[model samples]
Every structure is written in structure tokens, then in C-alpha cells.
Target: MNVSTATVSLALRDSPLVAEQTRERIKDHARAIGYIYNRRAASLRTSRSGIVGVVVHDIMNPFFAEILKAIESELDRSRQTFILSNHYDQLEKQRTFIDTLLQLGADGVIMSPAIGTPPEDIIVAEENGLPAVLIARTVEGAQVPVFRGDDAYGTALATNHLISLGHKRIAMVGGTDQTSTGRDRYHGYLGAMEKAGLPVDPAWRISGPRTKQGGFEAAGQFLALKDKPTAACCWNDLVAIGLMNGISRAGLVPGVDVSVTGYDDLEEAAIATPALTTVWNGQREVGRQAARALLDKLSGASVKPSQELIRPELHVRQSTARPVERS
Candidate 1:
């Protein structure tokens, strides 16, 4: 009660300048008196909104949800507020979100950049004082700290696992070539096929599906291929699960009649109709590291612009098996 006006102000705002005991005492007294601190006023005074932005492809997707959970946990420890957005691979939507963050003076952003996101977009955000960290996907010329799983390595693990099960005619289902992630995953599948001395038919690469519905819809096309693939290496678990469901709809037993492999061992993969064989893409680690890198940048630490790739592991399950002849 005898503290200077400045000390009272700092105490109400939870600033460390106030002693812990005094700060708690002041807070308790304020609560007793029904005093509410004005966060907006505090933000204006300190020039820090305490807000960080996280934009990803889709929040509903379990893959991104896992990453976001990790990010939220890390940011919670720092007592930083975060704003989340889904660009849905739309460049314009992503740009709009970045602009909004800049206008609101957000401290930083962690993004799994939208498809075709130019490097300049990332540069512009940084130049305007919003430091950037990339996750999941990469913009070729963006010089920012990036945290993601080794896509090529992860998909390669899935492909190789299917190959090990004696699947020679393997198809890569889901994902497009528009984003770096798509390209890396496809290349991983391709490389694994080549390395295994398996002939890759052009039709085996089914691009343009990154969702469960997309995968489900693509099932007919997949099944209709003249040279039927004995196994499918899906873009992610969602797609693999969807494809498996479609396989069942078509009266074929997945894992028995047709084997399927998925990337990103999301939580649902294990409980899928036939437990999915998948690659552990380290989504949580990527999210945690990306959030930490951005927080470091906000704390005035020098974060070098580099690609940090978390190594991936393969988890074998019921959805994959040796090739069975299909009439």
C-alpha cells in the first residue's frame, strides 16, 4: 500500500519489476475490490500485444491439431497469447492473416505457409517487425527458422515398409505438387520405389488430394487403374484412413485384399478400422520447436535461419501386408 504509483501499475500488469509477494498482495486486493486490469492499455504502454500468430493449412486436421496443441503448451509456459488461422493452402487468405497480424502489431508468427507463398511475403512480415518461423512446409527463398519433420525420409519409410511387404506395384495417393511438403513426400515415395528396383507407373502417382474426403473420392479412380496397385502409400493418416474406408465400401478388405501405408502417425491412425501402418512425422516436436524458435526471436535471441528436420520413424500396424493378386 505504500508503493509508488509506478510499482502499483507494474504489479497490476504482472510485470516482474514488482516483488512476487507484493504483486500477489496487490492482485488479491484488486480482486477483492473488483478491479479489472486493462490488457489493451498495458499492451499499448509496453508496445507488446503479447499475441503470436499461428497459421496452418487446416486446424480440423489431426496433424495440425497435434502441432497446435504443442504450440499452445509452449506458449502457455511463456504466458503469451496466440491467434490461430487456417489458410487452407490459399495464398490470399494467408496474406490477409499476415496483414492483420502486422496491423495489430503482433509480436511474431509461426506458419506452415500456404501453397505458392512467395518468399517476399515472409520477408515483408519480418521487415515490418513481425519475426517469422515456418513449420510443416517451406518457402524456398524464405530465410527464416523452420521446424518440420523430414518429409522425404518419413514417406520413404512408409514406402519402404510397403516394399518390404513384397508390394511391387505401389501407388502414392493424395497430396499435390503445389507445396514443398507435397513435392518432398512424392519424391520420397518415388525414390523409395526406384531404390527398390520397382517400376513406377505414371498413373500410380495420384496428386491433388490432401483430405479424407479427397482420398475417399479418389478411391474409385484408384481402383479403376488398368494396372491395379497392390499397395497405396498415402499422403497422411487421414487420407489412408479414408482410402481404407472406401476400400471397404467397394467390398474389398483393406490390409488383406489391398494394403495401405500412411504418413504422419496421428492418434486416430491406431484406432482406424484396420489400424494403419504409418510414419511418425513428429508433428508435436515440430510445433514445439517452431514455437520456441519464434519465442527466442521475440526475446531478442539471434535465431539462425535454418531447416531443422526431425527424423521420422515407421510404425507398423494392421493396414499393410504382402500383395494379394487382384483379378
Candidate 2:
């Protein structure tokens, strides 16, 4: 039996205008024919697209990839679709992506803001009644709900662990004054050193991009120093691995000659030569929370502009150890 589009529509909507027997017959016929409803046509009637946008700063990072997977899984349960874009930590790219998603009629957006981008653009988007939530990293003054890991607390834990291993002259790698995460981790390292009454030398602190190459270059800089630190705290696992490679090139063994610690505990951290001692930030949890916030907004539920911080866990591996002798 062939079913008409109008009959199928009525059946799908469960319209009272259709008799019970007719609706059942239409539904059965539609299913038998493998007929799929046109979501766009349905959206035209209800004015809901059931689409969300996700903007990530670094799509290349495995951690972000994992988080994206979690977001996709959660949204799948609602039969909603998401559009994805990568900002590459560039403000212009982020702005363009957001505008494009808006033009594409995204119901809401979940974003990790580009480094140094002001929140004004996001504010404008929200003013247009577009619900958005910040994930992983937040805009400075945006009223959007934010979900991220506790950077300071995590860094403090890593640094304290190094200190407990009798590493007093510890160096820091892969942080700059640009991003809040970098600044927070740096401050945490400083705070830990201060609490232990350990003096942090200016030469031991290095600033570079949060990339593998950046970590490699920073490690070379540290090796060039006359008074080298026995242990180094890196921004992330990628950086830590890069630093380890550079240390090897400089004729030193990572776990033996110079202990290293990393953050984020990316998958590669566990497979590194010495394995990396790093902090595990709950990236999937951040993604899930951000998705939940955006879904709440899309469902016309009231959601406050609140910040949720997920605690981080330290994974101690073979990458770090106590100094063999005093510096």
C-alpha cells in the first residue's frame, strides 16, 4: 500500500484530525516503505532545527578529539545533529566560524574560545538570542556558561608531587602570558615553589607555544643554561614528550638525567619512552557538561551563566623521579 505525504505527516505528528485506524495504517505503511520524515519540513512547521554548533580551539589535539566524541554521543541520544568547526586558536577564524554557524541556523553553540579573543562577539551572538556555552576555555567576560578543568589545582598537584620527590630546582616549560590556562598553571607552579620555600630562578622559566616543537625549543633553551634544573614541569603531554626528545638529543636520558612532568595526560603520554607523569583533566566530562548546558538552553529551560570546574587527577608514571644528587 502506498501512503501519501500528507497522510504520513499527519501520522508522524499524531494529529487528532486523523482517525486512529488511519494513523496506524499510515505509520505501518511508512515504516514498511522505509520512508524517512524530512526534518527540515518538520522544522519549518515547528521552528526548531534540532541542530547545535561546536567550536574547538585545537582539533588536532587528541584530548579535544575525545571530548568531541563525548559531545557527539550525548547529543545523539536526543536525535540532534551538531556542526563542528576548528578555531585553531585564532580570533578571526573563530569569528568567521561562529558567523557561519549562525547563518546555517544552528540552534545553539558550544565553544572553546580562541586565545586572546574578547567576549564581545559572543555577547553579540547571545544578544541575538542564540544560546551558547563555553567549554575547556572561556571568554573573559562572556555571560555564557563555562565548563573546564581546575587548571590551578591540577598544576599544584603536579608541582607538589615533583617537590615531594626532592626536586627543588624545578623548571617550567610551555606557558605564556597570553592564555588563562597558561597563566594559571604558571602561577600554580610558583605557588607550590613558594610554599616549599624553594627559590624559582628566572632562567629556569621558559615561555613558548603549547606545541611539541615549542616544547622541544624550550628544552634546548633550558639545556643551554649553565645551572640546569633537575626536573621540569611541561604544559601538556605533547610538550613533555617533545622536551624528552630534545633532552635525548642533548645527550641526556629523560627519566634518569632530567625528570619531567606534564599535564592533560593525553593518550600518547602513556606510550612515551619513559611514560609521562601528567595530570588527567576530565576532558570528556567538560564536553558532556557543556552539551547539557546548551541542550537545556535549546529546550527553553532556564540555565544560569555558571562555571563548572572538574577536578584533575595525577597519573604518576616513569617520566619523573628524585634527583640523583643535589644540584
Candidate 3:
């Protein structure tokens, strides 16, 4: 017990200032004494908590499950403690989480910002020393590293696929214009429709549904359209699946009487009742790269504030087919 407190402190911190043998001896003795390292105090001293924040729309959503899994894997390798939250597209809830992270001295944040999230919100996080990396969604004018699939292109692929199947009357289900993601996806669908020389009925664009339940409820609305669509290109797999369920309840089978295509090729997409045909939006890649970039920032590396757009691919499944010709 004659060791100087300075030597003990250095040894406890695993500082190279102490000899290897001395450091090991101190650690062993400290362990025997049941001494607990005060990470909070240490964090207060070094301003590093070794904590990261990850907030998504809804973790329960299958669309985000794959992305979160990939992100968890990447952050685990760096031994970072990640705190996850669901904002449910609520701006205040998301800001509250960000504030909590800032107060707790979190090193960085990876977020899929909620709808109506402003660039200033991200800027505030950065100004307060919480660097943010965007995934799945983007805040306009936010100068931060954003890693997400090319949503516009992805939706276009799905729309074009339906067009090829000879569905002139296609309905776009789910999503709203409050977010960049929503606008991009809708524009993608519009682009494809125009390219195919198909008339886009204003009623065909149904917005404000981003979940399975929402999509299920939209089924009746879709069915009530003056010129009912023979095919529906859903915002995501959840909506697509839900709409199919609603359709089935109405005594209609998906992929037969009505063709459907979903975005985000979630695992369940392949195993849905009819096996969904969807666009693979690179969820895993987006998560992995976003996490890696944030970790790099935490390591004192300079990251270019640019968009890393991962291209999407289409997976044809049983959920879609040529629309049946009406007599």
C-alpha cells in the first residue's frame, strides 16, 4: 500500500506511464479490494462517455430491424454502448432524446430523423459536441455524413416493375410529404408513371400511412377509388403486407386479382402470404456505413459531410404479377 496515489491512478487508467508489471499488480490488488471504476467521474474528467445514441422511427418495424442489426454489429466491434430510442416520427420526442444524449456526454449519434426534422436540429447537436450521422432519412441543409439507400431510385424500380407488368392504373399507398424520404419516394413513383405514359390520378396518391395498420385501413379507401387500381406500389413491406391482409379480408387475394409491390425487402417480404416482391434498399449497408462513419468521427477522424447513397435492387417475388384484364 506504499504506492503513490499518482502511480495507482495511472495504473487504474491503464496509462503507459506505469510499468506493465506495476499496472497488472495494481489492477489485481484493486480487484481484490472490490474497487469499482467510476466511469461517470472518469467521463466528467475526460469528457468521453463511450456512449452512442441511435434513434429510429420504430424499432418494432421490420424495415428498421435489419438496419439496426447491422448498426449494432458495427458499434459492438468498437465496444461502444448504444442507447436506442423510437421517436415514432415525432420531432419533440426525437429532440428530447438528443438533449438527453448531450446531457449524458454521448460521443456521437446515429439517427433516422423524424418527419419535420429541421437541419437546425442536427446543427444544434453538432454545435453542442454531439456529432450526428443520418441513416434512413435526411434533414435538408444538414451538413453531416448521411448514409441511406437511394430511396427515389428504389421506389422508381418498384414502380417500373409494376408498369412492366402492364398495370396502367397503379396506386401508391403509404407515406407523406413531410419528409425528404416521403417526397423522394412519391416523386420516384410519379417519374415512373410519367415515363410509362400512364395518367396519374390525384386520387391514386394516398399519403399519411407509413405502417401496417395504416396500410390496412387504406385498403377501403383504395378500393373506393373511381378507377380502382389493379396494382398498388406500397411505401414499404409493412404497408404492402397490411394492404394485402385488408384485401384478403375483403375476399380478394393479392398477387392475383391485384398485383402489389413493396419497398424495402424486409425478411418477412419473402415469407409473406404471397411472398412480397420488393426493392432491396440496402438497409444493412446503410446501417453499417453510418455506424462506421460515426465511430470514425469518435476516433478523431474527419468525415466528409456528404451523402453516401447506396443503390437499390429489385427482388421479384410472388406478391406481384400482371394485372388481370377486367371484362
Among the numbered candidates, top TM-score falls to 3
lDDT, candidate 3, 164-258, per-residue tens: 98899999999988878888999999999999899999999999888899989989998889878999999999899999999998898999988
Tens-digit lDDT string for candidate 2 (15-57):
9988899899888877899988788767767767788888887
Candidate 3 stretches with Cα past 4 Å from truth are none
Q: How are the candidates ranked when ordered by lDDT, highest leading?
A: 3, 1, 2
Candidate 2 residue 129 Cα shift, in angstroms, is: 2.7
Using all chains and alpha carbons, the TM-scores for the candidates as numbered come to 0.94, 0.92, 0.96
Q: Clash pairs of candidate 3?
A: none
Model 3's lDDT to the true fold?
0.92
lDDT of 3 at 188: 94
Q: Is candidate 1 or candidate 2 better by TM-score?
A: 1
- The global C-alpha lDDT for each of the candidates, from Candidate 1 onward, is 0.91, 0.86, 0.92
User: What are the per-residue Cα lDDT tens digits for candidate 1 across 6-56?
Assistant: 888889878988899999998888889998777777777887889999998
Best by lDDT: 3
Candidates' RMSD to native: 2.1, 2.3, 1.4
* Candidate 3 displacement at residue 14 in angstroms: 3.7
Query: Which stretches of candidate 1 lie above 4 Å from their native place?
Result: 1-4, 13-28
